[model samples]
Target: MKILPFVALTATLFSSGAAFATEQTVTLNVANATCELCGPIVKGSLSKVSGVLDVQISEADGAAIAKVRFEDSRTNVPALITATTNAGYPSRIVQ
Candidate 1:
């Protein structure tokens, strides 16, 4: 079976020096993300998210990845999806 891809919320946690943590991950298959032209759009969209520190879009792979580091208390995965959708590329929250 072919499971649908999750375009957002690929959060990863890393230890911070003091009391901070980072959830950085790769989201896949934003349906509208196609062609080389979609790269910038995807990246720009993901970058607008509050927790996201950076974004990387691969047109060849149809992937929109977000590097997010949130306050753990502030937001959660679903918010990430909303951010991408707000930018016009609605996405799923990958596990």
Candidate 2:
């Protein structure tokens, strides 16, 4: 019946909506990235996270700034921070 088809269509639309991933980017101020070698280490740490898409590292004021892009549904700020901390670099959200 026409009503049954419409119901099926509506259900399909709603169900598929959940499959879309929400992406987010955050800048973290990383501490203990004093040496030049620290950039690669921080980048590697962030990259190891499951949902992290990309990571770029730069230095400012003797600390490292990590710009990270990740899938929000798969990970979050806390996970990112933990990744860096576990890698021996402590970090905080840049605001």
Candidate 3:
């Protein structure tokens, strides 16, 4: 009886946190992906970031474009930039 009410309240509280977690997708322009190897390197870097759900990197016409989906509560655009930049590929969010 009393325990049931407590369990319900706890479940509601935990579930509410899930409601606040938002998924965001962003496209980034990455520099220095001049070869076929660059795409894999960039993808590997972004994939290691926390909360990164998906990463698609394309190296075409000497440009690298990465489309990423992530949970905003655990990561953001800046973190994504840092991950790629640290891997020797500087990147910025495409407006």
TM-score: which candidate is best? 3
Give the range where candidate 1 is weakest over 10 consecutive residues by summed lDDT. Answer: 5-14
The residue-by-residue lDDT of candidate 3 on 7-44, one tens digit each, is: 99889988767658999999999998999899999999
Note each model's CA RMSD in angstroms: 15.6, 3.0, 2.4
Q: What is the lDDT of residue 13 in candidate 1?
A: 28
TM-score per prediction, in order, is 0.54, 0.81, 0.84
lDDT of 1 by residue, 1-95 (tens): 23323322222222332236445564545667666666677676666666665555544355554444443344565776676677777777556
Question: Pairs clashing in candidate 2?
Answer: none
Ranking by TM-score: 3, 2, 1
Better of 1 and 3 by TM-score: 3
**Least lDDT summed over 10 consecutive residues: which range in candidate 2?**
13-22
Put the candidates in lDDT order, highest first.
Answer: 2, 3, 1
Those runs of model 1 whose alpha carbons end farther than 4 Å from true positions after fitting are: 1-20, 60-74
Clashes of each: 0, 0, 0
Q: After superposition, how far is residue 79 of candidate 3 from its true place, in Å?
A: 0.2
